[model samples]
Target chain A: MAMPFEARYRVYWHHTDGAGIAHFSRILAIVEQAEEDFYASKGLLHVHGRLPRREVYASFLYPLRRGDEVLVRIWADEVRRRAVRYRFEILNLTAGRKAAEGHVVAVCVDSEGGELKAVECPQEFVEAWKEA
Target chain B: MAMPFEARYRVYWHHTDGAGIAHFSRILAIVEQAEEDFYASKGLLHVHGRLPRREVYASFLYPLRRGDEVLVRIWADEVRRRAVRYRFEILNLTAGRKAAEGHVVAVCVDSEGGELKAVECPQEFVEAWKEA
Candidate 1:
C-alpha cells in the first residue's frame, strides 16, 4: 500500500474552544485541509470545489491545544466512478499521540444551470490517484 | 420516544464556502448548537463543555446556502452512565427538505488537577434525560 500524504498545521486560537482544546468541529476542517494539500501537491487543483462531502465521520482520541502542531495524514481509501473516500489521521506532534481520525466521502457534482448534478470523477482525478 | 428538541439557525457568510453552501464542517457546529439549546431548555446548562465528543458523524443530503434558515432538531438517542448519543437533523426551512442528519457521541469527563478523567454522568444530566 502507498504511504498516506501528510500535511502539518498548528492549532490556532480560533480552532480552540472554551475547554482549551481544539473544537471537535475543527477536526474536519483540518482533515479537509490535508486533502486539499494532497490534491494540490498532485497538481489536481482543478478538482477543488467540484467535490462536496456526502458524509463525514471522526473520532477524537486525545485533546489538542492551541500552539500545538499536528500532522495530518490522508489516504484515498476508495475511489469510485463518482466519489472518493479519504481516510485521515491527525497526530498531535506535541503530545506524540493521535488526536483524531476520520473519513470523508465526497461525491463529484456538476453545477450547471444552477443545479447540482452528480457526475463521474474527473479524468484528472483518476489519473492523479493512479499515479499516487 | 419523545419529540426531539428543536433550534433555529440562519446560514451566515462565515458558514459558507466557495461552493456557495454551508461548509461540511459547519454542520457539526450547527448540530452542537442545537444540542446546547436542548440542554439549556432542559435547565441543564451545566452540561455544556463537560462532555467532549468521542465520535461524530454526518450525512449531507441537500445544500444549504447563505441566508437560509434551518431548523435543527436533536434527540438524546442514548443516555448512558457516562455518555450521551445525540441524533440530529438539519431541516432547510428555505428549501423545505432535510439538509443534513447526524449523531454525536460525547463522554463525560472531569478536568481536575489538569487531567481529563472519564467520569460518570452528572446527577443533573441523568435527571434531565429521565424527565425528557
Candidate 2:
C-alpha cells in the first residue's frame, strides 16, 4: 500500500463554531487543502477546478479547538473512469487522537461552452496516482 | 408525516468554488442556517451550539451556480436520548431539480466549566419536533 499524502494545519477562530470546536463543515475544506497539496506535489495543480464532489461522508471522533494542530492524511481509495474516491483522516495532534475521518467521491467534469459534461479522469491524475 | 421546515437562499460568489458551483462544504453551512432558523421559530434558539455533529453525509445530484436560488428543507429523522438525526434537502430552484440531500447526526453535549459532557436532548427540542 502506498503512503498517504499528509498535510498539517492549525485550527483558527474562523474554522471553529460557537461550540469552540472546529465546525464540521470545515473538515471538508481542510481535507481539500491536503488534496490540493497532494496534486501540487505531483506537479498536477491543473487537476483542480475539474473534480467536483459527488458525495461525501464524515464522522467526527474527537473535538478540535482553536489553535489545535491537526494532521490530515489522504489517499485514493478508488479510481474510476470519470470519478475518484479519496479517503482522508484528520488527527488532532493536541489530543493525540483521531479527530475526523471521511471519504469524498469527486467526479471529473468539463465545463465548456456554457455546459457541464462528465469527463474521464485526466491523464495527469492517472499518472500521478500510479507514481504515488 | 409532517412537512419539513424550509428556508430559501441565493448562492453568492463566496459560496462557490473554482468549479463555478457551490463548494460541497458550504452545503452543510447552508443547512445549518436552516436548522438554526427552525429552532428559532420554536423559540428554542438556546439549542444552538449544544448539538455538535457526530456524523454527516451529503450526495450532490445537480450543480448549483452563483446567483442560483436554493430552497433548503430540514426535518428530524430520528431522535434519541442524547442525539438527533436531521435529514435535509437542497433544491436548486434555478435548475428546477434536487441539488443535494443529506443527513446530519448531532450529539447533544454540555460544555461547562471548560469540559464537554454528553447530555440528553433538551426538552425544548422534543416539544418543537412534536409540534412539527
Candidate 3:
C-alpha cells in the first residue's frame, strides 16, 4: 500500500453551520478538491481533458464537525487496465481521530470514443506518492 | 403530522458521478434548496434576514443513486420556544422506494445575540406547506 498524500485546510465560515461546525457537504468538497489536486500534481490536468477519459465516483463514510482542523489523506489504491481506485481518509488532526474514510473509482478512455491501450502507473508519480 | 412540500428536479451532470448516479452531497444541496424555497414561498426572504434569528442543521440518512429522478419532500416537524425542526424524505419516483430520510434543526436568536421569545409557526406558512 502507498502512503497517502495529505492536505490540510481550515474550517471557514462558508464551510460551517450556525452551530459553528463545518457543514457535512463541505467535507465532500474538500475531498474532491484534494483528489483534483492529486491528479494535477501528476500532470493530468482535468480542466482540459475531454472524451470522459477518466471519471471519479466517491462515497461518504462519516461526518466532520465544525471547528475541527482536518487532514485529508488520499492515495491511488490501485491502477488497472481500465480503472483506477483512489482512497481517502479524513482525520481530526486536533483530536487525532479518524473522522471519515472513502474511495473513488476512475476509468481511463481516449480523446476519441475508442479506449486507451496499455495503462500503466507512471513511475515518478507512484514513487512520489509512495514517499508521501 | 403534516404533509411535506415536494420539489422535483432532474439529475444533471454536475450532480452525478461516473456511475451515472447522483452524488450524496448533491442530495444535501437539493434539500437545502427546497428549504430555502419553502421560506421564500411564504414571503420570507432569507437573503435579507439578519440578527441571526434562525439557523439550520441537517443530516443524511441514506444514499441516492445516480440517474435517479428524486422528489424531495420537506416540512416543519415542530416549532418550539427557540428551535424549529424540519424533516426531509427523498423518494425514488421511478422505483417507488424511500431512498433517504433526514431532518434539520434550527435555532432562533436575536440580533444582539439574545434569544427570540415565543417562537410560533406562522399559520400562513404552515397552511401553505400543508397544502403543498
Candidate 4:
C-alpha cells in the first residue's frame, strides 16, 4: 500500500449551501487540490503528462459545515497502463471524525501542440510510486 | 420513461479549476441547483422534510470551461421507501455536447428540533412524482 497524502482545508461561507453544511460537490474539489499537491511535491507536476478524470465516487458519513476544518487524505489505490485511482478520506478535524470517503480515477494522456491522446503510465511515475 | 428536469447555468471564473476547465466536482453543483429548482416548482420544498445525500457518482465525458453555457438536466432514476436517486447530465449547450453525466442519491429523512433520523419516503412525494 502506498502512503497517503494529507492536507488541511477549512470550509468557507461563499457557498452557504443547503442547511449550512458543505455542499457534497465541494468534497472532490478538496480531493483534487490535495492530489495536485502530492504530485507537485514530487516535482512531477507538468513534467509528467496530464491526467483527465474519468470517474468519481463519494460516500458521506457525516455532514461538514462552514468553518469546520478537515484533512484531505488521499492515496493511489490502483495504477495500471492507462489510469490511476486515488482514494480519499475527508477527516473532520474539528469534530474528530471521518466526514466522507471517496475515490477518483484519472486516466493518463499525452498532449502535444494541442493534440491529445491516451497514453500508458510513464515509467518514471510508476517507478516513483513503487519506491514510495 | 419519465421527463427529465432541465435548467440552464453559466460558468464563472471564481475557481477556474484545473486547466481552465470547470472542476469535475462542480458539475454536480449545477446538478444540485437544477434538482432544487425542480422540487421548488412542485412546491415540495421542505413540506415533506429533508433529503440528506447518501451517495454520489459522476462520470466526465468532456471538459467544461469557464464562460461556457450549459443545461443541467436532472430526473429521478429510482424511487424507494427511503431513497430517491437523481440522474443528471450537464449538456454543453454552447459547445453542443455532453459535458458530464452523474447521479446523486438522497435519502428521505425526518428532522425536528435539531435531531435527525432517516425516514421512509412520504406518500405525497411519491404521488407527486408519479403524477409528474
TM-score of each: 0.95, 0.95, 0.47, 0.83
Runs in model 4 deviating more than 4 A are A47-49, A110-116, A128-132, B46-49, B110-115
> After best superposition, candidate 4 residue B81: deviation in angstroms?
2.7
Two-chain DockQ for each candidate model: 0.90, 0.91, 0.09, 0.62
Q: Please tell me how candidate 2 rates in CAPRI terms.
A: high
Q: How do the candidates rank by lDDT, highest first?
A: 2, 1, 4, 3
Question: What stretches of model 2 exceed 4 Å from their correct place?
Answer: A130-132, B130-132
Error at B15, model 4, angstroms: 6.4
Q: Please give the lDDT score for candidate 1.
A: 0.86
Model 3 over residues A1-132: C-alpha lDDT tens digits?
Answer: 456777887666788665444565667678777766776776755531321223223333323455668888888677664555667788878667776666655444342222223244445544544544
DockQ-sorted candidate list, best first: 2, 1, 4, 3
User: Model 2 over residues B39-67: C-alpha lDDT tens digits?
Assistant: 99888888878988999999999888999
lDDT of 3 at A61: 32
What part of the reference interface contacts, as a 0 to 1 fraction, does candidate 1 reproduce? 0.93
lDDT (tens digit, per residue) of candidate 1 on A11-129: 99999898888899887788888888888998887788988899998999999889999999888778888988878899999999999988899999999875567899888897665
* Docking verdict class for candidate 1: high
Can you rank all candidates by TM-score, best first?
1, 2, 4, 3
Provide a comma-separated list of chain B TM-scores, one per candidate: 0.93, 0.93, 0.65, 0.86
| Runs in model 1 lying further than 4 Å from the true structure | A130-132, B130-132
Every candidate's lDDT: 0.86, 0.87, 0.57, 0.76
Q: How close to the true structure is residue A105 of candidate 2, measured as C-alpha lDDT?
A: 90
Q: Write the residue-wise lDDT of candidate 3 on B4-31 in tens digits.
A: 7778865667886553455656666787
